[model samples]
Target: MASTNAPIYDELFNVLFVIGTILFIGMTALVIYSLIQFRRKPGEEGDGLPIEDNLPLEIFWTAVPAVVILFVGLYSYDIYDRMGGMQILSNDMHSHHSISSQEKVWGGIGSSKQESNTSRDFPINVELTAMQFAFLFNYPKGEIISGELHVPVGQPITMRMESKDVIHAFWVPEFRLKQDVIPGQPTILNFTPTRTGRYPIICAELCGPYHGGMRSTVVVEEPEEYDAWFKKNSKQTEVEL
Candidate 1:
């Protein structure tokens, strides 16, 4: 469960959870108190005090939640920006900029200029294709694999993904990464795996009847081991073709 964005997402979730708990408890307490304290007298009951609206209380209730919601929205946006969500703006703004022939554009959004200039040493590039019930992964070296994605630990990996059929979603709960795979629209997700292990890749979209079965695994391995795995798979693919 080690990923660059996991902590940020966790922090956001904690904030929301705490606020929701406080609101629930406070509201419940007020409801129960009103039921007991404002209940009808034992003998007679025509009407309770002609309660008039208190401007301060009304304003407090309205303004407090409004402020809380505003704060949460801003905080969530900041966290999302830090997690590379702002890359969408970068891509959109640079959509018409000239790029090298070596660079490719998938669809709606492509890599930003800054992302295109990423060093070749790390940050391996990969393409993902989503269909009805499976994910297809293509490595930088023209190797194609299905059912699992592999990358070296501690190195950033950028995935450019699109859907082959209807809309789909790629989600890895541990990585705190989830992005829509839209038909005719390409999207990108970048993350660095900090640990070596296997984690599930789940389709978080309701695409079809078998959507629940659309699951895969991501394997993070040591650099040398990942290289070995890649070479072995590439050679096996060559033989099959």
Candidate 2:
């Protein structure tokens, strides 16, 4: 089975951190050196010199920030591609639908050529309805469930979320992305969860009194295991009905 690409994301983060560390060190060194060297000396009165224009220095600093901003913009875009483009929901996306305009612009940058494939083999669709505190999941079978979410591993899952009451954020930290569950209208997010484990699906947005308690679990199991679980849940649900 194909595994999750979290390590690659972590490595990218480490790279950015290295750059940040360099910036911090450079700024700190400059500040410390200036404080010690340009401090008001002993027995010295406040005889400050008039400030003059340093056009070259100003341009240098301005250009530095511009370059830094551009680099950060490009680096962030590259990371978005690594998360499997619109596959933010699951792996089987290529089999189900074509690449619509939304996927291209949803996560800041557009996807790569390899990610723009139209057809897929096994697409997973999950409809999420968010309310005051928790999210309700609706599968194609029309059964409503709560608490835990079950999905088959190594497949693309397209999550369509809508707010039942107010705005809510559907976030899975492990997935490294989130989309708001808006009111009245539906919002979509896609991802392919590679690992077969229980991942927390938290409501990152504050809704109401029980906002802090809003939580759910995402269980990623093997294909067979997922099918079995669904069958069992269906039988139990039918018995209740």
Candidate 3:
């Protein structure tokens, strides 16, 4: 599973787990206790009273459970707020963009949204195009972008992804993140890989015959090491292709 750096999410989850276990045990005990204490028989006297309407007990169960659920909800919301993120990027609010005199009309690059533009700070921009059977990552040169993606640990990397033929979902189980690559529409998914290890990146959708085999590995490494690997891979990509 994707690891989380947010301690509050972990703490809230632990509290929830504990409460759930308590609730489970309480429900089980209630069942067992009722089975034993209220077992009906002919000789039973004043024991088999029908509890069709116990207002106090009903209110107790309802209110207590509601309160517990409220606690969980409030705690979860607090955690989400703390873990959300920096506002340099958002659903709205972009920098004023414009086409350069040179590469004029590259669409959104120099579009009017360039004022508060979040795309500019994406350390290394990656264009991920998903086709029927594979995901091709493109990195433009003269700007230090490369085909083989290399990321520094704990830095947010945005993958500007889209599809050529059909919709495909990009997911990494270890990071617990997924986003769909839709045709004619670009999707931006930004995530920072905190762990230094190789993780599996798989297409979590059924696209075609090779859908199951459409998988890749994202290798996270130290900042310096990542730079070295990027340099090596850039050379290799040109020499090979």
Candidate 4:
């Protein structure tokens, strides 16, 4: 499935991969050149000229990696912030402001109605409960489904997840989204699927003996199709319950 976050992840991967490949090739060439040029030939080696370190060479090596790391760090942080990693900090700031201003925070404490409404515009909210070897999804309208998550294409989806027993991870590789499901601490993942298809959901964390079995499917469909499926499933769930 095409995802909103897929391009960001792909760009980051391409940057890192290019940098790594260049570094590896350069280092290998340097090693080979040094070995061939400084070989012990004709008794011309006396402790390798006392091995004096050059300040320029030392500075170059140190500064290059430092700069590269700084750039990558800032770039990754931008991506993380865009993916809602900074929501926690935003919550804290809102909390502080609410206390200081003596004004009730709209939509409840640690909640931003503006931000929520913006991100959740026509979005489907799904609650994911992680257990030993399975995932259960609950829709906002009280429909529950096991082993499958259904969302409408071209609309936003917010998954609020929590673990029942231990820590688990919700990962959909095709969507380039993953979030930890911690016990007693809820987490949210917001994404909009651009394509309509069935994709796999994987548990990336080692939660239990059957962690390998923690797998499910996400079905993205058109709005009308999704509505029909949801209504039919809701009725079936009501009948079963």
Could you say which candidate leads in TM-score? Answer: 1
Alpha carbon deviation, residue 217, candidate 3 (Å): 0.9
Score residue 197 of candidate 4 by CA lDDT.
94
Query: What lDDT does candidate 2 reach at residue 33?
Result: 100
Candidate ranking (lDDT, best to worst) = 1, 4, 2, 3
For model 4, what is the alpha-carbon lDDT of residue 28?
100
Model 4 spans > 4 angstroms off:
42-47, 89-121, 236-241
TM-score of each: 0.83, 0.74, 0.66, 0.81
lDDT winner among the candidates? 1
Off by over 4 Å in 1: 89-120, 236-241
**Which of candidates 1 and 4 is the stronger one according to lDDT?**
1
How do the residues 105-160 of candidate 2 rate in per-residue lDDT, one tens digit apiece? 23311122223233432345567788888888766553546457788776666666
- For candidate 2, give the lDDT: 0.67
Tell me the tens digit of each residue's lDDT in model 1 across 153-184: 87777677878999999998888888899887
lDDT of each: 0.75, 0.67, 0.62, 0.72
Question: How many steric clashes does model 3 contain?
Answer: 13
Compute the lDDT of residue 31 as modeled in candidate 2: 100
Instruction: Using TM-score as the measure, name the better of candidate 3 and candidate 4.
Output: 4
